[model samples]
Target: MTLRPALATTLALALTVTLAGCIAPAAPTPEPEVSDGLAPFFEQGVDWTECGEGVDCATIVAPLDWEHPAMGSIELAVSRIAATGTARGSLLVNPGGPGGSGFDFVRDSIRYVASADLMEEFDLVGWDPRGVGRSSAVECLDGAAMDELLFGQWDNAYETKAWVTELEAAEAEYAAACARNTGPLLEFVDSGSTARDMNLLRALLGDEKLNYLGFSYGTFFGTMFAELFPERVGRLVLDGALDPSIGALDWFAVQMKGFDDALVAYLAFCVGQGNCPLGGTEAAARSTFTNLLDTVDAKGIESADGRALDSATLGFAIAAALYSEENWPALTSMFEEVAVGESFIAFQFADSYYGRGGTAEYDNNSFDVYTATLCLDDDFQGDEYDVRSGLDAIDAAAPLVGGYFAFDDYAHVEAACTAWPYAPKKQPGMYDAAGADPILVIGTTNDPATPYAWAKSLAGQLESGVLVTFNGEGHTAYGRSNGCIVETVDAYFIDGTVPTSDPNC
Candidate 1:
């Protein structure tokens, strides 16, 4: 294995049973509802009770579908770590998953996600977006069904007629499943709607302005917030930002390239080490990994649990390891095991990436919400010619991982949203928050998920955005061990200091 950059890198019937259920309420607070349409949501108080050490958990109601305020409502799970010192205001944080669990992020991983200075000065708040974990989630397949759909093998290659048909079928089946299980809430999980829900939460929190820190997909949510409620935006920091201006195909292509570049960097690092499993040269390492993928594609390896580790799973495993340099040693061990005909570690990596737990159950509904939100957000052309063109570009840009990423035997981008039932409610385009306060956008030079270019593009797109460059590896930059990056971000959030000019660290 290689290391990256600086060693851091059914019909409506089903809907009845599932959609009728409500999320188990946490402590409830009594607040009077006003006559306004949004009053119930805004005036609703959170009955916070101690959940974990120094963490309070609560749930608030937002309309299941905002468009029809009279319709039913959904409960959003929220968690907060109260400020130790004088609180400036609420610092709403999201870990980025058009599916990630902000509730868990704050409740369990607050120390990793925020700095001591931040924890001391702000009430760190995290909420599961509508149609996500703990929130009124979009229920779909059961664990076994999901395991099969997500991890099972497919029989066609990209650009092939069969491949396109199979992918469209899978997507259609997925959409139907969601529609059957999620009811009216299915269409309301879009980023724009979530941003609206966020605004209501802000009001409920008694904050006139929204202060947010969003990472990865959360950046998209932050962008939508600034665009929708520019005046309400306050101290927004979008790290590993996404460029809303780009279409889905373009975004996927760019991400593939980023992962490819990271792979090469990892290969270089591995070669420098004495006992790299791949080979001595970067090219040699690429060739070795490519060959390994081919081998897996032809005859999938068997995991200790007896599950088959196909090329698609292995590819995902490798990509997951590239997210951070801390995982580099694990990747090396994975490759070592794979070399000896073992694939349990590869499956483990893939499982971790998908948020799977040790008992073979998913920890949350991240994947379900991810697909639902993305389908509702991006417009997919699903044109075969366009798919082939995108595949060509990806393969040319990233030969080592491109095949696995764009067209492996299992899945391809062309098939993703083609058969989705809902039309894109949130169109992909530029965001210009002209009247908002300064927003800080941080980008890592070799970020595999949200490429650095996106940060630059997002910063340029927002009239008041300032780009902060971290010329290093890994996904998000702030609070990940870099003192310079940490200090700059802290100053902005704590002292209201915006970088006079773009700063490259």
Candidate 2:
């Protein structure tokens, strides 16, 4: 809801922290058989050098276009923390942005990435998938342009033709900027291409099969990997799974409802806290939030940096806070300031969501890559009329945040991909991942971004998929949930222990 997973935040921190005191050099993995054209990429040598206190980093080459190998080449940044004990094998992890930096995830937050037992038993590997950070990325507008695109105030009424035209114009300019900046690479950042890249990483790492832990959008990426190479999966754990089979607009509608429900849950908790700034009753708290949005919408609050805090930015601030209950107090604090006409706290949350620095520059190319991959991955169907009709349903389902999710307007369902240059490459469908080893699919009951129903849908779709439910809040379950989830995930990765039944913790 903070766009992607909250863990994917580009908050800069010192990179020298070490999870384990010692590091052991890993024995090189064997190369896998591949066609002559890809042989070089698969057989290329890797030089892992100390990049962090206890982590080694390397850059690998991947084909820019898998269909035509000689088209060009791109670099993939990879990092790993060697197991504290004898390693079972390399366990690849992706922390859920179609654009999240797995390279940063492992290198910076090794302990937060996985449990002690799992890290002790396996070499924890992370990589920036193609079109993400530290890889051959999808660049669009620069910092000032991006800030204007994301936070610039719009005055047109959302449902009007003028609003639709303005939206399309902005996106067209955005798409053109992406094309000008990224060139041919923007067209090929689809999930399918990234899946191929994942397989390449697996072969170069010398792992006979891929052992994966993917969260949120990472689940979609992992599912793509499994579908492409069913027989090559090894103990895949997809937490906060996504159902790629759903259409883009429909998925948006359902996810908005999930976030709305999470907001209600948060309101209930806030009301029970006695001195909650929102209100003493659930209904009162809902009104308090809506009042803040109305107040901000009527007269936008300008931050010291000159960006106006409109309903759109305030809505993102609320959505970002709903990603976890730990962030609930931040939401309360944000409201407390808004109640007094202050914009600083809301800007703090929204800027963090966009990874905007104090200088108004983005820390990473996440938004650019997120847009490219999203538009390229799924075909956003429907015309303006259809989008208007769908908005009715979304608004009906999620009265609180529905308009925000749809840009507070009734434009076409293709909001993000409106003027993108390329059509979607992925045909939404079921992925069985046949013949793969047992795949663990985890779902948190109240996860605002990737809903629990999606996890059930994906698990039911995969042939060897096993569902693990966490009855809790937040976007992901593994490493952050209860002991049952941590132990269940660790046992599967460390000892290949698959639960016979759904451990609905």
Candidate 3:
């Protein structure tokens, strides 16, 4: 139950949009056309009425492919929460899935994520980015297929060609499924197009500037926004910022190391606590966890959940679970429980890492979109040797723990893009965008997902970007905890106050 997928804390390595004219300034493109074929899905002919409280959902068409605007069109589903009370402006919030749903993100966890105060001042905006929830999504491998694949024995017997074959089959099955249900939407889901959609939303929102609050990969969405329209950036918060410079392999490898770091952090916390089952020695627990992985690899364990636990999946599960501190206690409990008599602890971690669909099957979107975005964005070598090298580094960085993190899992994203049905338009600054106002960036020291190094990279990349550090343990900060973090963020939003210096939370 490590939940490192939160990838929020590691982002503290640091701390840590755009524009348009208003008031009848620009001419309307020849009237916008309905996104081809997928128009009905986005317009939601099923529900003519908008879908939320104080919100309206609609379709805005942009070129199916930005590069060939006149040739094709694609529709993005959008939702907006108009300003209530005294309004500051439209604040678009993204919950970092690359595949995550932003539609209801504002209310997902108002108390801990979007502060009540911030909500009152700004009109909350959320959307199911192109190929994500509520928004027309990509679904090749449904839940049941994913469940079967999730419990497979890859982490341990990966040494065998059978497991490698299994992984290859799974990867292909997933890709084919996407082709069946997703059609050409995959081409449009890339971050750059999403940013264009954001601009359109900003225009429709009638906001003078784009006020954005992006979490996890959402940070990249925000950065792209800034680069696209630097003048339109209002108050922006990037939590668990991603390192646009890193390739997918690097992202995966670094994330593995991030988990190791957070795991040690958890061990240190457990060792000192009187209730800690691992006792008060983090180093001992570290050894214990490693030994458990080795033990499970050799002899699988049974959990209360009635599932047989092996090393690979457990490692993957725990690595994912450690992304946020909120998941730490649960992780510790599971590890302790597994040590005692239940192997089901691994299943618990799996459930959290990959939530079930309404049909009781797990969603593979994380695995899918994760692949789509990273693959499309990075120049993946697809060379097994190159990927193995990164994985080896993770393994060396932290023995028993890094193997799961190895970047070789599904290195095909980039490879697939090579044969993508359509051409791709690499954004102007897929990684580097220098010169601009100080972009206040926040990174949670314990973030397991995006990791702190990403924050540092982001700060270093943006000429005017300043790094703000949050000492807490969570996925995204600002509203997650710490009054100081909140105040600093609010100032940036209201007064354009970039931290005079990086504030270490």
Candidate 4:
């Protein structure tokens, strides 16, 4: 199983249903005065065309290599809605996939992503980062190859030499496909480069400083921006933050524990509901769930499409639902359907997580870019022995969920990195964005994807960080969370008001 990093469910059914209202496109803005190697990129005008009702779409060009502008350029897809009221500046947003389509987020789900107040005061902008949808993306497998990669059966049992060899071979094949298809672009898709791209966008958009709202993995992107151009920071809100200092193994371990804890929390709520499908008690529910997983692992259930519903896919479905409390009822429905030997609901959840469609093609290149970006951004801090020890620790932290994540000693995790064609471009370390404006960092106490500890870690690391804590569940806190979180964040952006202290809501 590929243990990907924390991803925000901006495309979740609940949020995506809320369509952002459009406004008349504003007149073209003039370019900022600039003279540098990157000046042409900043001075180039964006030719915006109305793609939707009042939403304008445009493409901006940035250097493929920031250090050397002569290397060539890549196109970045951008979309925006003009402010209803007079605009202070553009409010750039990222829904956080590392590969999430910010352009789609703005075009489709702006109301859900941003508050009405903020949208009225500022032009809401979204863009697909490098190697993402609608931009210069990383392409590897087609639908059939993707299905085999994500859901194909493994005949071998756990921990054997056969299993290890098979896993390593599969990872190598995938890496080779990425290298062969993506070419040199694959090496520069890391968050560090993306952050540089954002700065260029900020300048091209005619904003004096960046005003960004980044969720989940976008938090890392935002932090990288802050670290790189501390003086250019304006109003930045990083919700569901990731601690950039942590290495790959720790990222896996904490993510597993977070999901495990979230599962426990869900069970606590589920058992109290009428006709709860799992069991009467949390422990009973866990036992029932594990048994179900074991049964699925041992003998998979065949879906109508003839695909097997195995333990790994079930785990993905579970993780997908755990992203939001709003999705808990869907989890219960999945459990109920699977109990009756129906894999439809489970498959639906898993497919959404993977961005797969009913047709052969995927909706986007998220899965491909997710892996590519991760391999480049992650710091493999140890060798094979250290990796083995780390995997054991992960299993210990999440005794129930971790097993589903791995078959045995997960040498495959490290093996994938070892076989990756490119070296990691960004090193893992603390980012103290000194000389920057006060940045608001928000964290949910029980976020399944990005654990709450990461928020505290990031907040402490930033020299001008002000933490807004939400003592609740789910992946992010700003839009879906309580009034305290929404108000704190909205006030920070709309007005220049930073919280005096953590509300601890």
- For lDDT, the strongest prediction is 4
Task: Give the top-scoring candidate (TM-score).
Answer: 2
For model 4, the stretches where C-alpha displacement exceeds 4 angstroms are 1-9, 12-36, 381-390, 406-413
Model 3, TM vs. native: 0.83
TM-score of each candidate structure, all chains considered together: 0.90, 0.94, 0.83, 0.92
TM-score winner between 3 and 4, please give it.
4
lDDT, ranked from best to worst: 4, 2, 1, 3
Query: Backbone collision count in every prediction?
Result: 5, 0, 50, 0
Query: Which residue runs of candidate 3 sit more than 4 Å off their true CA positions?
Result: 1-56, 154-156, 160-162, 302-307, 357-360, 381-387, 405-435
Tell me how candidate 4 scores on lDDT. 0.79
Output the better candidate (2/3) by TM-score: 2
lDDT of candidate 1 over 1-505, digit per residue (tens): 0111111210001111111222233222223433467667766666776776677777889987777788889889998888999997899988887788788777767676578998899999999999887888888788777776777666775457776677677767877888899888888899998998888778777777889998888898999999988988989999988998877766777887888888888888888885889987777888998898877755657866666787667877888778876677788889899988888778877776666775458867777787777777876644343555666766676677744755531133345456566777845355898799999999999988788999999999999999999988787887674888888899999999999986788
Poorest stretch of ten by lDDT in candidate 2: 19-28
State the lDDT at 208 in candidate 3. Answer: 60
Candidate 4: worst-modelled 10 consecutive residues by lDDT:
14-23
What value does the lDDT take at residue 222 in candidate 3?
Answer: 89
Residue 220's lDDT within candidate 2 is: 84
lDDT of 2 by residue, 1-505 (tens): 2235445222346665333332343333565457778777877777777776778888889999898889989999999888999987889988877788889887877676478898899889989888887888888888888887787765576556676667777877888889988888998888898888888887777788999988889888899999988988988999998987777666777788888988899889888877778888888889987776666777757888888778767777777777777888877778778877788888887777667887668887877777788888766533343445666767776778755755632232256576778887855356998888889999989988888999999999999999999999988887777899988998998889999999888
- Per-residue lDDT of 1-505 in model 4, one digit per residue for the tens? 2323234446433222233434333333344444477777776777777777667888889999888888989999999888989999998998887778888888877776577888889989999999998899898888999888777877775445676678778878988998899888998999999998988888778787999999888898999999998988999999889888877777777888888999998998899896778888877898998898777766657677778787767876787778889889888998999988888988887787778887556888987777788778874423343434665777788877665654421344466666788888855356999899999998899987889999999999999999889999988887787888878888899889999999897
Residue 286, candidate 1: Cα error in Å is: 2.0
